[model samples]
Target: YRELLLRQRINEAAQAVMVAYAMGGDLDQLAANYNVKRLTVTPADNDAVPPVAAVMESDEALRLRVPAAFEGLSVAGPTAAYEFH
Candidate 1:
């Protein structure tokens, strides 16, 4: 718990530094101008977008042990309660 809190504080501090740098504040000059240590970041080699939709579970992949007639019915209201002739 103690270590997690310390890591969270460090992360928040880094985020603040990033926000300041984004608002036209010089990162390298922060130490000399404001007497603060500038946060350094190295860009990753592969900055590709992740294929999230490809690995998501589809409707067909849902596992239910119910009958076929009760498959897509919603039991929340009286509209689905009527039986078909």
Candidate 2:
């Protein structure tokens, strides 16, 4: 059961990554959450592979074709309500 739970958690994290890939230009919040890290993005800018969240939010055409899950995980910026990112 513990293994199953871990698998589920891993899958959830993967889904989150997919979501981030959708949004365009790699917003800081989405990338951090999906990767389970505090802002460790590579390239400093969009390169061959952009951040998951960045791909989805982007209206502009992306070089790579991201998935629909990207549309779902639109992790908001630091909430003004709680002042948390």
Candidate 3:
């Protein structure tokens, strides 16, 4: 039991260092390091009889965007610069 608990703790710690494999809130935190924020795909509307659910950008999409953001920093106007913005 003690060994299993230690392994679980080690796995949790590894998530912070392994941003590429991170998901959900962990991914969000990692993206913030690159000054990227998750975008909302669908807005929530509570005024309607049935409230609409809000859909956010997926972790996979955000992961791709985060790296692309760095390309925007360059002035050379690479292909990624166009996509980044």
Candidate 4:
């Protein structure tokens, strides 16, 4: 997938999370849709474009770059919910 397309997907995911959060959905439920785990440090990698965070990459490799800009998040939103760790 193209980098622009992947970023779009990541943005979509982030938006969904916000929606779910607004609806008071538990983190697990939202995470489930996003492949997030419980209590574990899940990579917020949103820089998933073209062979980076691809659905085909090995799990370990994807997890390693979770903290990246595209993966983690570079921009702040109107109601930005993410915080630096």
Best by lDDT: 3
RMSD of 2: 14.0
Question: Considering TM-score, where higher is better, how would the candidates rank from best to worst?
Answer: 3, 2, 1, 4
- Scored against the true structure, residue 40 in model 3 reaches a CA lDDT of 99
* Models ranked on lDDT: 3, 4, 2, 1
Query: Taking the tens digit of each residue's C-alpha lDDT, what string does model 1 give over 1-85?
Result: 9999999888766754552322223333333333333222333344457522223222222111112224225465443334310
Per residue, candidate 2 scores C-alpha lDDT tens digits across 1-85 of 9999999888766654463443433433444443322323333444537444432323222212133224434566323323222
lDDT, candidate 4, at 74 = 39
**CA lDDT scores, all candidates in order:** 0.37, 0.40, 0.87, 0.43
- TM-score, every prediction: 0.24, 0.26, 0.86, 0.23
**Between 1 and 3, whose lDDT is larger?**
3
Which pairs, if any, clash in model 1? none
Worst 10 residues of 3 by lDDT: 12-21
Ten contiguous residues minimizing lDDT sum, candidate 1 = 58-67
